[model samples]
Target: MKRFALAAALVVLATVPLWVGSTYYVNIASQILFYAVFALAVNVLAGYAGLVSLGHAGLFGIAAYAAAKIMTSGHGHLAVAAGALAVTLAAAAVFAVLALRGTGLGFVMITVALGQIVWGVAYRWISLTNGDNGITISGRPSPFGLSLASPRGFYWATLAVFLLAVASMAVFVASPFGASVRGTRDQPRRMNALGYHVWMIRFLAFVLSGFWTGVAGLLYLYYNQFVSPQAVTLTASAEALLMVISGGTATLLGPITGAALVVVMKNVASAYIERWNFVLGAIFVAIVVFMPEGLVPGVARLVRRSPLR
Candidate 1:
């Protein structure tokens, strides 16, 4: 039943460009799709592996820089994809080793420091990053000879890639190694007793998450046709965390919901209100105080208890 519902939802999303036509909202939808993938990356660590990070934006920002730099340097879209993913995964490995050496607040502090380091490099290294000016790439991103020039074209492309990411995450979560990772998350001592390398599992999860995030960054680079230091700030990382926590942990679709919500607030709601940040803060507080499990899971729990099922 859940599978059927998910399929229906995807079908509806796949038809957005066709039904909604090319407009500002369609562009917003594209943002939602890519950002949803980004949120899913955060889900892999915080939701599945019991690891929280405050430096996620750093990883995200670095990947975007890598993609923009590679493409602007006359690399093909294929190279941009491969090189960016590789760079981010390598960075993720380093972050995991440094941040995963501890848990809770210690882990959080390490991640913040690591993320800040990345930001500092981007900010100070004007020769490489062009400093705050950013790298602006020209023309459409044509992968496999298909031009993602038009809004509809890009939207469909984003959907196809988003589905691929979702499929990959689904397979990973259902695999034996994924189960072991979850086991480690729940009971690391017991998992270690079972001869499973707990740290390795967590490391792999971290790297995997980074891979997805890099994919999102690549998409983001072309989506905006620009890259800037603003993309990798601590606030961006916080927004990713908010997406995960506000939507629900340990659930695939929760972060996507959170992403959609945040995008709507940032784009639509903020347009009408002068103090949109205040509104967002209130929502965050409500999520923390009331729906601690996230809006998706909290609503799901409510539905389950209301005799609607």
Candidate 2:
């Protein structure tokens, strides 16, 4: 019943642009989908694998730059997007090997350091990335001759990719490998004693998480038609973490909801307040203090206690 209701809700949401009929709203919705993908990728690390990453934006930005470069070089958007995912996954494998040396705060520091390094490269590599000037994609690409330039077309394309990503991750979370990853999270020492390669499992999760994040980056590049060093900054990394916390860590839909809420709030508040970061910070603090489990979990608890449920 719950699943059916959720499916219906999604169907309604997919048609929102038809009713809203605003290019601005379509762009906003596209951003929601993009960030939702990013949040879900982070959830794979922090929520399922119990690995906290403060440097995911590094992977995200790398994928964005790769996708934009590929598209600019005459590759189809879909091809570029796929290439971005592949490169990110490969990078993740390398990162996992290096990161396996430590855990907890040590792992966090490694990721943060890696993120800074990547940011520096993106900023300094002026010939390739164009530095702080950023890169402008010539135009949106067509997959098999289907144009994706219009805002409405881009929105639909984004929605389709987001759904595909969500479905793929959902299946991944249900597979045996997923169970092994969760086992590592729950009892790493025990899993190691049981002769399981716990490091390998976590490494695989990290790679897969990077792949999804890369896909999100591709969508972001297409949606915004631009890529810059700012996209990969520590601030972006922190925003991804906040999205996971605000949505509900372990729940599949939590990250999506959290991203939507945060994006919408930012848009609305930025219109009225000059200091939007202060408002965003206040909201984050409020959520942490009063709803630590996130909006989804809090609502679920409320539903459980309700007579209607």
**Which number leads on TM-score?**
1
- On a 0 to 100 scale, what is the lDDT of residue 232 in model 1? 82
Model 2 regions lying over 4 Å from their true place: 307-309
**TM-score of model 2 vs. true structure:** 0.94
- Go through the candidates in order and give each one's C-alpha lDDT: 0.89, 0.86
Q: List the pairs of residues colliding in candidate 2.
A: none
Worst 10 residues of 2 by lDDT: 138-147
| Per-residue lDDT over 65-95 for candidate 2, one digit per residue giving the tens place of the 0 to 100 score | 9887887788865688778878888877777
Q: Give TM per candidate.
A: 0.96, 0.94
TM-score of 1: 0.96
Kindly report which residue pairs in candidate 1 clash with one another.
Answer: none
